[model samples]
Target: MVPGLPLKNTQASTGDTFEAAVLAGLSRRPRAIPAKFLYDAQGSALFDAICELPEYYLTRTEITILRDRAPEIAALAGPGRQLIEFGSGSSVKTRLLLDSLEAVAAYVPIDISGEHLEATSRRLRADYPALAIVPVCADYTDLPMLPWLPGSSGAAKLGFFPGSTIGNLDPDEALAFLRNARRLLGPGGALVLGADLKKDPGMLHAAYNDSAGVTAAFSLNLLARMNRELGASFDLEGFAHEAFYNPAAGRIEIYIRSLRPQSVRIAGQRFFFDAGERVHTEYSYKYDLADMDALAVPAGFVRTQTWTDPGRLFSVNYFVAT
Candidate 1:
């Protein structure tokens, strides 16, 4: 578990438990909030907008790779497979796989935002009327178990984790997540993983710090969420979104920085911020093929194939669980 963040208590509702986390995170030095808190309904919508930005090459590049490779991916997945997607946002890229896969037994899309998941599932149901579409609304990292899908018995679990969301987690957390996924996927399972490749710092900077400020809104929305759910008095305008590439770390670090000295109240508790103090919100780590293997191999996944665009900006890898 990340410092100051408590383990998910299965008994408590997500909203009920968020207050404690918000308070604990704010109380710590070099304050940081879990990135998952940034995915409330509004935040999720803002992120969808981010994907459409011209500066954001990740979405389009990965989509192109998935579009081009879906057939080949399907061939490896074989028939009667149950597709399980982690962090299935709008599931825009999933359509390609659904269309190409032969006789897919079921499709399970797990997401943190319930409203967004429901909306996406409805749209998918309409389009794939014959397919069994199960939408799980929970954090994929702490998901307890998947609902049993009827008629999916003996179907291979083909896990799809796209958009390089794995970058959001620290190395240890990423490894833990992959290990959990391997267990959830069970024997004869596989994962179609997308990862953003290490590249020019200029390009990386532009991707996260878009001129349109959609990414800014997406990052700041975390504060807005605290205000709404935890009765926190956060001045949204008082803080600015900061994102830059950390070359030494080989990742993009994002923070919500305090513009001036201020005090904020959350759940009747007060906290002060110094001028220019930053509260870390997210980290998007870039990876090379070797880095990916080093991370995934220890988690019990063997890389079978990898595909990248001509620019080599992003990678889509096919890994089978051992």
Candidate 2:
């Protein structure tokens, strides 16, 4: 039952992804799983909850920037363009852009979580019935060449990567993604990106380690997911979530630390953890304006403009592919 057109999932690639995660990747010196794996249906829902917590300022700050400057952002994106969003979770902020981009031809959202992506796309369809909603379930980092979408050919392509997701990638991977985006969007394309600014370490720590425990649940969901999907034996109670800022690295790192000496078996392979041992889950690198602008130049993009909230906690940058 192949899902046609508007709802498509790259099954082969996703299967390979699972194989890698279960067979070899899980049994590493310091076990780590790519953050993409953390967004299965349940994980995605938990993250949505995390965004609503009072401690999480990143989501609201970026939304404010978009709400206030949408027209200006839309103008730079140009009219009659296709809006292709990478890692378009929930698409909560996407509505602002969609409402402002009067001549937008179509909306293409790419996400790794197939079920969650489809659900979000369905909701968007109901709200924006007149618009074409193309949802693709695929990795944004290594995107397959985009097909020529209807009503999208002649119009400029506008790449929307909000959520400061670029921060999740290290500098090298982020540059590579931007460069690949350069090729995907072609010379006439523009990218609207959100980046979290470097701020007080306390604020950074609080954002990831929210008081409501949603962030912790999101981290633990990864383990629960492994137990369900990979046939792993992980005691959800045996590990604790920890997130903190690494000033030297300019990133916030999240880990699941073992509470005591423990062993878990995934796909029939055993891995042991000493007390206090941790498996790295995610890294979110904060960026200042200058550092972020420099990242674009090497990737063949020109940082034409930026919009930020009054608090300056976040930035939405407009980059033109050259």
Candidate 3:
């Protein structure tokens, strides 16, 4: 079981804010909610399941690259650096870097899901007893600053942002995030970023529209979350999960569409939906080396090295803040 925030408490703690967000999102045209809210304990568990599905090649492919290139990555990052991960999740891929880095100063895993972060931190502490482990619970994108790494004033900071989570942000938001990250990492710091490469649209569609329907469940859970936390009367049966690759946009667009006309009440406000009306859920953008450079350069990072799998399905890049 995940530690720290319990399900009931998680719901309670985020209730007011979530209610406000839900109301605001519904108030807007072409309704949408931030993707970060999708990772409640239950949703996080579902996503872990999605990663294991046969069609989901991203997780396994990235892991293979990390496994093969960790030593080389460590060499680039050098010795006694403080490691920080954004959207740390289970911190599964971190093991490769932790084992390879020489005399690491500390490990900090920042995540929005308190339960997930706490549980992962506990396991990591047990496994790597000597290393300092600090887990910060916050939305990494909006986080103002990180906690100070004790006794490591002069140590380099290496940011680990695997899993292509950066792709969820729009281009402007992504550039802003990269800029914020550059400031946080400071001079002499480095980042290891994972990006999904553009590929056959059929393969991309298959990845999101999995055969087992786990992705569908994941997308629909947003509604269930509202019902539980925001006193929203959302009929799960009324909506259907839809996802497809938008090649022109170079991203996967996900949404929950109303199967039929329906009215839902939340926080004493009723909203009507027309048949087939949709609420945007998330976007996963694919990037090539040039696109990566475009993003990193203006953010004050210079790409030092990049590693990709045999198929070039994904890229792991090392960038230094200048």
Candidate 4:
């Protein structure tokens, strides 16, 4: 359980703002909510289940690539550097990197979930007794400025951002995020990024709308979160998960469609919806190799290398300051 923090009353700034914006956006048309909100405690658990679904190939494919290339990545990255992971949820795929990077001096995992971070960090420290685990309880986007390392004359710091989470942001936002990271990492640092590549609509659709219903449950968990945290009276059965890949947009759009006319109150406001209405929940933008370069180029970084799985379902890209 989350200690010292009230998970029952906890709320995320981005998730809260995005939810209201999405609710308003739905008034104009059927829409999807941002995927970030799905990280609440319950949503996070459901996503863990999604990773096990056969149709959800993203996690497995990325893990395979990481395992296959971790040695090479570790060798090229050298030793005694800080390994900071953004959105370090569960640290499921992170073990590969930690195990491969024998030269790492310290491991820093940052996330919005203080409870989750502390728990994962504690477990990692226990499992990897040799590693120094410095867990930071904060949002990845606004992580506090890091202190300079002791006895190091500006050594390179590596940034590990896996799980295709970059797809959560739009192009400009992605670029800005890269810039922000550049500022935090300074020169000579590197960024290892994972991204989903554009693929067939059938595969994309199946990945987000798995047969096991894990994805649907993950999508709906956001409502349950709101009900618990924001005093929301949402009828979970009145909303259904809907997901599809837009080929032209090169994105996956996930939404919760209303099953019947309903009225719900959240944060003291009443929201009414007609049958068949929907709220935009998430847009996961896919990227090609070139598009990934475009995102990093203007942010003062140059793509160093990219590793792809056999099916090209996912990419692990390495970038360095230009």
Candidate 5:
């Protein structure tokens, strides 16, 4: 559970904003949707279920690494740091780091879902009373400045972007985000990030297409949200979940393909879908340690250390601002 009271909510888009974004994404030639939009309350809950699925090794593998190596990660990161975590859903994994860090001044957890963040933050505050908990309800990607921390001055800035979420952004967008984090952390600050490593295609495919169908429900929730918020006329049953590893791209491509010919409307605009036409939803890009290091250099960070599990399914990397 999240501890502490809610921080001043950071500004985010309104319901109408969802309408415009849907219009734009659907207007594209290939019809792609940003992964960010799939985190509405229902979608977020389904994702939590997806994490627990047996085939999804990401959460379990990464947790084992943090459970064992967090103390080492914190020692190199040093003390009296203000921890800022991006995409901190549920914040369950954050407990490992919070426990290991010596003297964290405050914890600022940023997420896209305002309602979800509030509940998580409330419970977290109960657990760690001495720690300042500032939950910002905003998309961390576009955030220009962080909210005020009650006693945040004089602490080293420690940025945490875990969950291999950096893979969600396109390479250019990821670079921009890296640069932004460098600026946010400033000199002498450091960042710890989790990345999914390139593995056998079979493992990757199974992780996305679990037997219990939670992932399918999670993918389909996007349509449920669109219909609710944007007045979209999408028949959720008409679509089927499709996720597969793309060797050429070194990523897992997830799409919701139309099972039959259909038409849908959102905010008065209509879109026609042919049988088997796909609405591309997400891409989980896999990376090697060297590829990550190459990205860090141009973003003003120097790769410090990286730890991988025995099975080598995932990695936790630490980088310092140069």
Candidate 6:
């Protein structure tokens, strides 16, 4: 059955052209582009393959932490609250949250990819027939206002932000995101966030640059997306995927470096790059407990509890709305 407006996932703008969106994003960061764009239907499928690669330990580590501590986190979430998730790509880690928060009446998954989001939501709805599924095909950074959960008279909300997607945002952007979340959640809501912590550079580099070459494929797929959607001529073979942890920057930078001097034309825009020059694709920032808490507190949240893997490679933090 189609959900009512109050329960339906709100889409900000479905008709917005993806090509125009990508171009504007490229202009914003001449050195890098948002990896979120790489999740076009095919790109999203490729990324699922990437997470399964043995070298990518972030997914595994986070899953372990969630599975072991979800019950406790759910208890903290309380009962009969709406579950709102941002950047809900695939939402694999969400199972732990939902399983723990059995009192939740709704599940909202927000994503930039319409096709992928719809498909995943449909499957999830089938599996969890008891829960209301609201999949929003909109950018998480600019989510539209949503209604309160059923059976609640403006009761408090619970936000589930899993997968350490927070690492993608820089310090300032991360702070802004936290502030925005705080505002949307209001005073009584709670936020459960997964964060990737600082770790060894070698481990970080390997997770991004895997042996099966899936990560490389995931990075290059952005160009493939452009070529297909924007009538651009990007020689996917002329570039190599390069990713490494920049310790100085406290982040992992993924770039598609030109194998040799190359000129790529996109949507009638011509750009030239010298040999070894690269177009940055993503930055996965790693933070410590103190750094994350410092960013969270000013945003009107007080850390309630944190669950981490034995290795301390990732942490799931529960914050009460202030």
Candidate 2, residue 74: lDDT: 79
Over 186-278, each residue of candidate 1 has an lDDT whose tens digit, in order, gives: 999999999999999999999999999999999989999998998888999999999999999989999999999999998889999999999
Ranking by TM-score: 5, 2, 1, 3, 6, 4
lDDT of 2: 0.87
Query: Can you write out model 5's per-residue Cα lDDT over 1-322, one digit (the tens) per residue?
Result: 1235466566645465667778998998799888888998888889999889999999999999999999999899888898999889999989999999988888989988888888888888888988889888777888888876666666788999988999988788888999998998887889999999999999999999999999999999999999888888999999999999989988899999999999999888999999999989999999998889878999999988999999889999999999
* Total backbone collisions for each predicted model: 0, 0, 0, 7, 7, 0
Worst 10 residues of 3 by lDDT: 1-10
Top model number, lDDT: 1
**Ranking under lDDT, best-scoring first?**
1, 5, 3, 2, 6, 4
Each model's lDDT comes to: 0.90, 0.87, 0.88, 0.79, 0.88, 0.80
Candidate 6 lDDT by residue in tens digits, 1-322: 2242222445544434566666665555355666677788888899889878898888888899889998898788788777888888898888778888866767778777878888788778777877777777776776647555455545567888877788888888888888888887777889999888999999998999899899899889988888888887889989899998989989998898888897778777777778988777778999898988899999999998998988888888999988
Error of 3 at 279 (Å): 0.5
Q: Looking at candidate 2, what is the lDDT of residue 225?
A: 86
Q: What is candidate 4's lDDT per residue for 1-322, written digit by digit as tens?
A: 1112112212346456646854665455544555666786667677778888999899999999999999988887888677878888889888998888766766677776666667776778778876656676555765547543444435578899998989988788788888888887777788999999998889898999888888888888888888887778999989999988888879998888899999998777777888988787778899999999888999988998999987888999999877
Give candidate 5 regions above 4 Å deviation. Answer: 1-5
Q: Mind giving the per-residue lDDT tens digits that candidate 3 earns over 143-221?
A: 7887765577678899999999989998999999999999888889999999999999999999999998999999999
Whole-model alpha-carbon lDDT for candidate 5: 0.88
Error of 2 at 14 (Å): 2.3
| Model 6 bad stretches (over 4 Å) | 1-17, 24-30, 147-153
